[model samples]
Target: MNLYRIAKWVVSIIFYPLFRIHVIGKANVPKSGPVIICSNHISNFDPPVVGITSPRSIYFMAKGELFENPLLGKLLTSIQAFPVKRGMRDRNALRKGLQILKAGHTLGLFPEGTRSKTGELRKPLAGAGFFALRSNAAIVPCAIIGSYKPFRRLKVVYGEPIPMETIRESKTSPQDTANIIMEEIQKLLDLHK
Candidate 1:
């Protein structure tokens, strides 16, 4: 098996039982083609939880600092996570993300630039929307509903795909598209909470 799949198997073996993770609407994910999975940031565990539960392998856009450590960087790269400079726009990271999409691969992103201290949804960065519009990929809105407390029921809910046509037809800007994506994620939260 490839490193990413092997790592995912190991993580699933460890996390699923420890966290009592529950995945809902996983079938909503497209089996193939370019996809952007946008979810709210709650904890550091969010990325792996979402990744393992996803039906398709996802290349995540992670913070640049996480790659500073050589060992950690190599591990992350092996698992298909790329570094992105947070706060200011990083054109290189954006280009990498676009390239991933253009190659018809799945990319995972947390719209909120950082994890929420209060576990509440924050204003999302426009990167998600920009990626969606630019690549015309299917946007699968996801919600991670529960804290990372061990043995607790932590759910990863994947909502229906937000059609690119819907966003394009609305003529929304990149930021607006991001806002719409958040709204969909919020709906999943409300429905499952």
Candidate 2:
């Protein structure tokens, strides 16, 4: 198996039991075609949790700091994770994200740029909306419900795609589309919590 599959298998073996992870609405993810999976960030475990539960491999932009450690960086890269400088506009990272989407791959994004210390939904950054509008890809709002505490039931709920037409008709800017995405995420949170 490839690195992504191997890593996913290992993570599943370790995390499924430790966290009691539960995945719901995975069928909401498009089996093929370009797609963006936008989720609320809670803990460091969020990305891998989403990755393993997802029906397809997801390319993620991890914080640049994580890549400072060469070994971890190599491992992350091997599994399709790239580093992105947070708190600023990183053109290269943005370009990479668009390229992934234009190439019809699934890209995972934490709309809330950073993990929420309080586990509450935060305002989404503009990148997710930018990818959605620019690539016209399907946007799947996901929610990671429950804390990462051991033996606790953690849920990864995938919601229905937000139609491009709806976004285009109502959202004129990246932030506007981002707001809509957050709303969908919030709904999933509310429903699942």
Candidate 3:
């Protein structure tokens, strides 16, 4: 098997039992096509949880610093993660993400630029919306509840795909589109409470 799948298998094996990961609304994910999986970032574990829960293999946009360490960088790279410079414009990262979508692949990204220490949803970066608008890809809203800790029940809920039809119907700003996506994610979180 490919290294990406291999790593996913190994991590799923370990993570499933440790966290008791539970997923809902998984049927909302499209079977195939270029799609963007937009989610809230509460912890580092959020990415893997979303990626593993979805049936499609998702290429994640991760922070560049994670690739600083040689060994760790290689491992992350092998798993289909590309680095993005945080706290800046990061045009290169944006371009790479668009390219991934244009190629008809699944790209996973957290709209919240950074993890929330308090596990509360934060303002999201506009990049996810920009990607969806630019590539005309579907955005799958997802919510991950609870902290990423061992022996705890972690839940991930996927909302229906937000198609580009909404964006095409109007001249929506990236920030506005982002807010719409975040609203969907919030609704998913509310359902679990």
Candidate 4:
């Protein structure tokens, strides 16, 4: 009956068929809890793929440019996306993200900051780890395979949840934690190939 649920259904129903998305390891997703879905960015389509495939609402930090269309922006906001400066502090973006996580929901993040042109995994931006650490949310390292191509058979693999305690116990800085998550995502992609 609410707008967010309606928007989520519309997006998911429209996207899943067009993309032919294959979601694996969804069992790894906590049925109920705050989670950070740390992912490998491959294409512009990546965010929609993750959002539709998720069993729960997942928020992502979107580029400010995406909200240029007032109508589309309203729809995106309904499904849990908000704008943030791509490479700047963008305090508003950061606040929105943290607030989403703190409110006990999944917040999607591409640690790489942007898509990888070669479909190869890139070093994660420091934000992923920082947000997880700061929010104390479990990080679900996810890998989206073959999305670099338009309308391809995209596979999204969800690895085991990386506990916040493990991240802190490893004695790695937030940047290092982000890198570790990225590496784990890359390995998952390689495994499916």
**TM-scores, one per candidate:** 0.97, 0.96, 0.95, 0.89
Q: Candidate 2: deviation at residue 34, Å? A: 0.6
Q: List the candidates ranked by TM-score, beginning with the highest.
A: 1, 2, 3, 4
lDDT of 2 by residue, 83-134 (tens): 9999999999999999998899999999999899998999889988888888
Q: Across residues 60-128, which tens digit of lDDT does each residue of candidate 1 receive? A: 988899999999999999999999988888999999999999999999999998999998899988999
Ranking by lDDT: 2, 1, 3, 4
Residue pairs that clash (backbone atoms under 3 angstroms), model 2: none
Error of model 3, residue 104, in angstroms: 0.8
The C-alpha local distance difference test score for the whole of candidate 1 amounts to: 0.93
Minimum summed lDDT over a 10-residue window in model 3 is located at 162-171
User: In model 3, what is the error at residue 102, expressed in angstroms?
Assistant: 0.8
Whole-model lDDT values for every prediction: 0.93, 0.93, 0.86, 0.81
Per-residue C-alpha lDDT of model 3 across residues 6-64, encoded as one tens digit per residue: 87888899888899999898998888788899988887777788878888999998889
Q: Give the TM-score of candidate 2.
A: 0.96
Candidate 3 shows a clash count of 0
* Ten contiguous residues minimizing lDDT sum, candidate 1: 163-172
Q: Tell me the tens digit of each residue's lDDT in model 4 across 25-126.
A: 998989887899888887787887787777777888888888999998987787678898887777788788888888888999999999888888877788
